[model samples]
Target: MNALFFISQIIGTVSISAILILALAKLFSRRWRGQAEPARSRGYAVLVTGCDSGFGHHLARSLDLRGFVVFAGCLCPDGDGARSLTLQSSSNLKILKLDVTSDEDVQQAKKTVQENLPEKGLWAVVNNAGISHWAEIEWSTIEDFRSTVDVNLFGCIRTSIAFLPLVRASKGRMVYVSSVFAFFNCLNLGAYSVSKRGLEAFADCLRVEMASFGVKVSIIQPGNFCQATNILKLKTGSDIWEKLDSERRQIFSRQYIELATEYFLSTCRAGCEDAGPVVDAMLHAVTSARPKRRYLLVSAVDRVFFQLFPFLPTVLTDAVFSLSSMYATRTQMLHAK
Candidate 1:
């Protein structure tokens, strides 16, 4: 009875403290400078990539509702998901098929966006296309890492170059959909972490370069969102697993793969990353009178996690990840670790 009472008291105290902090944040957020200020017009046109599903699709649709012309790019425009979005939206929504790695496809999309715009070019371009990875560093190859960086980081730069003319003409903005991993490395996420780390550097350089041209570049670092798709689906490492020795192949087992993939999805589903937060941030980046250089869409805890990670010693972080991978291996009942 005493223990229960003590637990309840702690919970009550924490709840009160949380409310107070939130109240203060609401008050102070108003005075925060550099961020896009409240309630701005959405008359400009915007382009977003990877709009078949998840964050890209959500942002494209949300911007369309705000009266902005949205040119949404998907891998398959004639597919069910793209067709569905196109059918539902009015003529203001345009869907284009683009694979960022393909120079031809990217060039074509560039031409289409330029042709479709009214006298004013785009108000903003959202680079939301990316892939995910969760594999041990040793088991994953340079090729695997390269593929991720190619799409997630280098591809972003390519898209920006293609759209620079339009953005400059309209004095628009660039929003890169980076991840919390941009500044932090989590267990078995080396491929993604390194790519995002590179992206963070690129975004910083991009801001300085574009600022002179009246272009604003803001990077959005969102935490794990529960949207349908995630990156554990990539297997640059998986395809050649059997070619390696038994010791290494064991580490890349079917069970190991599935567990790692599902774990990310499970944690994502636990949170209510309401589209509201992202949409709100998007509006600020695109429509605000003055936009910030970086918008972290992650929770306060995630921000803290990223901040603390760089200070941690390499041995400690590696040990923690080693144990985590071992735990995932243990869960593979069929393999019987």
Candidate 2:
């Protein structure tokens, strides 16, 4: 009994000490963080993708106001978004038609940027174009996965390769707008999580490779700001269900689909409405002389949970996810009658 009691006491003490240490480290990190180096925005050129909506739109306007020669890439240059942006900003903000998934569009965008750049070349390129779909892996088709990757993963690659020369010439920055799902996988968002994971890897590789050339690469991981972006405006669960064959449809009940759709929309509505935090991170990555490798813009609760995810046991995490899924399924079935 004495030996058991001593072991428990030691374990408790060690756990307490570790928690205290972590608290102190976090406090110090915030208190003694170094300020970013000042950078001049005037005459510096930046290319931002997905300027037709959300964070990209706001960021383009903000940078333009700050005197950075902003090259905003919109999928539809003549659309309402582009027209609205034109009306809002000065002549310094020029909208270019760019479809990151299309090589021809990317090439044209590169050419357009080249024609307008100052002698310093491009100063920054923000890869912000992305899309998301909601459904389980089994419910989704191969095309669904491919489409997501084409925009989220291959799109970034296309843009980065096309603009690397200009960025290298100016020793500039490349900022990728990744998602918090890159670090923590969530239910019904496998494609998005996988795409962001691939992006994280790509960014890490590029960051290391560009270090010798004076090009800085940074990634912004934002959590649940779907209301501020077009992430939740894609195909609904019912739409995908209708397209599925009878066999596949039978695998997932109608009630489950209804519940999933309701859950997803509710979650979107619950997300942060303001895109300011994410845009601020992007601006810092572009303009800061000493930019961070990764910027995580998440709420305090999300931050703690994501930080703890890597340390949690696999079984525990799996169980938690399974329980949540089961609960949702049960609730939906109960109301089916």
Best model number under TM-score: 2
* Candidate 1: 10-residue stretch with minimal lDDT: 33-42
Which runs of model 2 end up more than 4 angstroms from their true locations? 1-39, 234-237, 323-337
Q: Per-residue CA lDDT of candidate 1, range 290-330, in tens?
A: 67777777677667756666688988766666567546555
Any residue pairs clashing in model 2, and if so which? none
lDDT of 2 by residue, 1-337 (tens): 9999999999999999999999899757955895455447876799999999999999999999899899999999999999999999999999999999999999999999989986566899999999896677877788889999999999999999999999998888999999888867766788888888999899999998998898899999998899888766555666867877888666677677777777777888898999999999998999887778888888987788777776799887666666676566755675665
Model 1 TM-score (2 dp): 0.75
Candidate 2, RMSD to the unseen true structure:
6.7
lDDT of 1 at 144: 79
lDDT of 2 at 157: 99
lDDT per model vs. reference: 0.76, 0.87
Model 1 whole-model lDDT (C-alpha atoms): 0.76
Q: State in Å the error of residue 278, model 1.
A: 2.5
TM-score of 2: 0.85
TM-score of each: 0.75, 0.85
The total number of steric clashes, by the backbone 3 Å criterion, in model 1 comes to 0
